[model samples]
Target: MTTSKKHGSNTALVHSDYQAPEGFAAFPVGIHHASTVLFKNVAAMRERSWQNKSAYTYGLHGTPTSFTLEARLAEIEQGEHCLLVPSGLAAITLVDMAFLQSGDDVLIPDNAYNPNRELGDWLARSFGISARYYDPMIGAGISDLIRDNTRLIWAEAPGSVTMEVPDIPAICDAAHAKGVLVALDNTWSAGVAFPAFDYGVDIIMQALTKYQSGGSDVLMGAVITRDQTLNARLQAAHMRLGFGVGMDDAYLVLRNLPTLKLRFDAHDASARKVAAWLQTRPEISKVLHPALAECPGHEIWKRDFTGAGGLFSVLFDARYTEEQTDRFVDALQLFKIGFSWGGAHSLCVPYRIKQMRQHWSHDGILVRFNIGLEDAEDLINDITQALESLDA
Candidate 1:
C-alpha cells in the first residue's frame, strides 16, 4: 500500500499527480464531474478559447460529461452548437439576455409559456428592454410587428396551453427578412418532433428534464444553434449566468436519450387516443391537439411537424366551471395532478386562459394533460372513470 506520509503529508499528496488509466471503455459515457480543471502547462491554458468550447477552462463553462451531452443534443437538434443551462427557462432568458439590451425590443407569442410571458412582463420590462406579444398565427404577417430596435422574436409551437400551432416558417422568414433572430421555446416537442432549424429558426431551446431525462427528476435545459456566431453570444451569456448542470443529472439525461424516440412515440399514440376519446364525450367542448384537425393551425402542424407529443389541452363546456375541472383532474387516478410533463407518469394541469391569449375567444374551462408511457387503453379507462366526477 502506498502511504502519502512516505513522501509528505496526506493532504499535500492528495493533490499530487496520479495518472488515470489510458484505455478505458464503457457503453455509458463516464461522468467527469470537475471544477478548476488543471492544465498541462500555463501556455496550454492560454491558447484555449473557452467561448468556442475548443478546450475546457473551468467547471462552470464545460466538462467532458457536459460537453458530451451538448454534442449529442446539438446533433439530435440538427444544430452545430449546443449550450446547457440550469433550466429550460434559463435557456430562454439566456437568449434574451445575450442578444437584446436596454432600448431593444423582443417579440414573444401571446400564448408563449407563462414564465416566458413573465420574463417579458417583469425582468425584460424592468431592464428597459421591451417585449411585445404578437399573434403567433400571424406568420409572415409578423413583419408588421418588427421595429428598428426589434432584436429578437420568440415563437412557441402550438402556443402554450391553448395548443394553437403557429406558422413557424412564415414567422422565421419574416424575422430573417428584418434581420432579427427567432428563438423558439421548443419544450413541447423536445426539439425532436419539430425541426426548428428546418423552419429557419435561429435558436431552439429544450427542457431536457422532460423527455430527455424521462424520469421527471432532472431539471436541465439546452440552447442549440447552427450558427457559431450566435452560439458565441449565447455561451457568453451562459457564463455570466453561471449556469451548469449536476453530473448525475447530465448522466441521467444521457442514459435516457436512447429511449427518447420510443417514449415519445408511445406518448404520442396514447395522447391521440385520449384526445380522440375526449372529443366524443359530452364533457369536452373542444380538444386542442395539434394532431387533431379541429385544432387551429393543425394543417400547418401537419405540414411542418413530423409528429406531435402528449402535451395538449381540452376546453370544457361553459357549464363546467373551474371547480368542475379541478374535480375532474383530482379524480384522475393514473394521471396525477401536476405541472410540467415528459415522464413515466401521466399529469393533469388546469390552465387559466383568461389572460393567456389575445386573439382567441374561449370562456370554457381549459385542462392540459401530459400522457406518459402508459397503455392507451388503460389511460382511456382512467379518463372514463374520472369524467364521472364532471357530472357531480
Candidate 2:
C-alpha cells in the first residue's frame, strides 16, 4: 500500500502506511486470515473469482494458507484438486449433496463409518434419493447391486472398527463400467498408506483431524479429485454450503504434515506388535487388523494397501460378556477410552459390532485400539493389566 495524505488517528491505525519488506523466506507457510479481502479498485474486484485460486474473492473461498494446505494435500494424494471443510463428515456431506439429487441412488458399505452410514440413511429417509447398503466384500459383485439410477458409490478402504479391507479395484472397475462414480474414505490411510486414485476412485475424502493434525487438536477434512469437471461440481457445492475452515486449523494440519509419514510408520509398527501379541492370547478370538492374517479381507489389503497405520480392533473371546469387556477397557491406565485416532496418545473404543453392521458373523465383543507413539512393550503391558480386570 502507498502512503496517502495524513488522516485521523482511527483511519491511520486501520490503514497503516508501513509495509513489510517483500523478500521474506520461511519454512512454514504464512497464515493468511481474512474475511473481507481488499482490492485496489472495482476493476480488480471484478476480475477476482472464488473458483480461481490464483486470486482471492472472500475468506470462505480460501486464503493463501488454506490454498497452500489444499495444494499440498492434493499432491500427497496424487490428486489435482482439493476442497477443505469443517469436519470429515462435512467432506462426506459435500460429495453427497453435490452429486446425488432427488431420484438418484447411492450405495454405501454396510460397515462404513457410522456417521457415513447414518448420512446415507438420512438422505434416503428425508430426500427422494435411494440409499442402500452393500456388503464390503461384494467386490465386482457390486455391479449387480448398482441400479440404473445409482449415481454414487461410497467405499472405505477397510470398513471402520471391524477392519475388513474391501477390494477397491474390483469395486471401482464395476462402478466405472456402470458409469458410476466411487468415493473412498481414505482417512484410515491418511493418503500415506493407500493411493485411492490409482485404484480408480473418483473422489477421496480425508479427515485431516487424525493423522494430518497429529495433535488430535484440529477438526478439518478435505475432498480431493483429479477430474476437473468433478472438482467443479464439488466447488459449486462447497460455495453453496458455505463450508469454510479456520485458518489456524489449516496451519496446524500443514505444520504436522511434514512428520505425518514418520508418525504413521511408528504407529504401524507398534500396532502390529500389539495386534500380533493379541493373536496368541486366549482372551482374543480375532484381531481385526488389515495387516493380520485373521482379519477379514487381509489378502485384499496386502494387494492394494502399502501400509496399515495405527488403528486396529480385537474381539474378546465369546466367554467374556459386554460388561466384562467394558471393565477391561476401563481398567487400562495408559490407553485412554475415546473415539477417533491418529495422535500421540493411544485410545481404546468398544463397539457393538452386530448393531453397527447389517450382518456380523463374529461372536465376541469388539474393542478397537489406536496405537500411539508409546513403547510397544508398555502398551502390551497396559493391555495385560486391563485383561486381568475382565475376570475381576
Candidate 3:
C-alpha cells in the first residue's frame, strides 16, 4: 500500500483503500461459512445462481468448504457432480425420496444395509412407493424382477453382513436397459476401492461417517453422480429437505481425504489377515469375506473391485447357542462390540441371519467385524481368546 505524507496519523489504518491484497497462496482452502452472503450490488445478487455452481448463493446451497469437497469427491469418484448430506442414512433417504414416487417400484438387494431396507419399507407402505428384494447374485437375471414401473435399483457390492458381492456391471446393464437408474450404498468401498461411475452406476452414496472422515468423530454422507439431469433431481430434493452439513464436519472430512488411501490399505490388509485366520477355526462354519474364495460372489468381486475393505462377517456353527455366541462376542477385549467401521477400534456385531435375508439361507449365527488399525497379531489373539468363551 502506498502512503501519502499529507494524510498522516491513522490514515493508512482507517481510510486506505488497500484492503484484500493479492498474491497470497495457501494450501487449504478458506472455510467460507455463512447463511447470508453479501453481494457487490443488486445486479450481482440477481446474477448469482445456485444451479451453475460457478459461485455460492447461501450456506445451504454451497460454501467454499463444501464446494471444494464436492469437486474433489466428484473427481475421485469419476463423476461430474457431488452432493454432501448430513449423514450416510440421510444420503440414502435423499436418493429414495428423489427418485421414487407413489406407484413406483424400487429394487433392492436382499442383503442391503438393514436400515436402508427399513427406510425403503417405510417409504413403501407409508407412501405409495413399492420395494422388491432381489438376490445379490441376480446379475442380469435382475431383468426378471424389473417391472414397467421400476424407477431405481439399489445395490451394495458386498451385502452388508452377508458379504455377498453383486455382479454390479451386469446388474447395471439390466437396470439401464429398462431405463432404471442404479444407486449403490458404497460405504464398504468408500467410493475408492470400486469406481462407481466407471462400472455403470448412475448414482452412488457413501457414508463418510465410516471411511471418509478417517475418524469416527464426524458424520457425513455424499451423493456423487455423472449425469446432469440425475444430479438436478438430487439437488432439488436436497434443497427441499434443507440438508446443510456443518462447515466444521466438512472441513474434517476434507482434511482426512489425503490419508484415506493409507488408512484403507491398512484396514484392508489387516482385515484379510484376520479373516484368513478365522477361516482356520473349527467353530466358524463359514467366513463371509469378498476376497476369500468361499464368499458367494468372490469371482464377481475379483472381476470388479480393486480391493476389499476392513469389514467382513463370520458364521458360528449352529451347535453354539445364542447365549454362547453373545458370550464369545462379549469376551473380546481388543475387538469392541459395536456397529460402524473405518475407525481406530475394531468392532463386532452379531446378526440373526434368518431375519435379515429372504432369498438366502444360513444355519449359523452371523458376527460381523470391522478390522481397525491394530496389529493383525493382536487382533487375532483377541479373537482366539474370545472364541474360548463359546465353551464357557
Best by TM-score: 2
Model 3 worst lDDT run, 10 consecutive residues: 10-19
How many collisions between residues are there in candidate 3? 0
In terms of TM-score, which candidate is stronger, 2 or 3? 2
Query: Model 2, clash count?
Result: 0
Q: State the C-alpha lDDT per candidate.
A: 0.88, 0.94, 0.90
Worst 10 residues of 1 by lDDT: 1-10
The parts of candidate 3 lying over 4 Å away from their true place are 1-22
Candidate 1 ranges with C-alpha deviation above 4 Å: 1-5, 16-18
Tens digit of per-residue lDDT, candidate 1, span 1-392? 34344456767656655567699887898998888888999899888777867688888888888999999999998999999988988888899889988899999998888889999987564899888899777889999999999999999997768888999889988999989999998888877799889889999999887889889899999999999899889888988878888877898999999999888888998899989999999888999999999999999998998778889999999898788889999999999988888999999998878866666677698899999988988999999998899878
Please identify which of the two predictions, 1 or 3, would achieve the higher TM-score against the true structure. Answer: 1
Tell me how far the alpha carbon of residue 240 in candidate 2 is from the true structure, in angstroms, after superposition.
0.2
Which pairs clash in the backbone of model 2? none
Error of 3 at 238 (Å): 0.8
Write model 3 residue lDDT over 1-392, tens digit each, in one string. Answer: 66566676777556764568689888776777889877889999999987779977888988888999999988878899999999989999999989988999999899999989898889888988998888888899999999999999999988878999999999999999989999998889887899977889999999989888978899899999999999999999999899989888899989889989889999999999999999999999999999999999999889889889799999999899889999999999998887889997899999887887886667888999999999999999999999999997
Our model 2 lands, by Cα RMSD against the true structure, at: 1.4
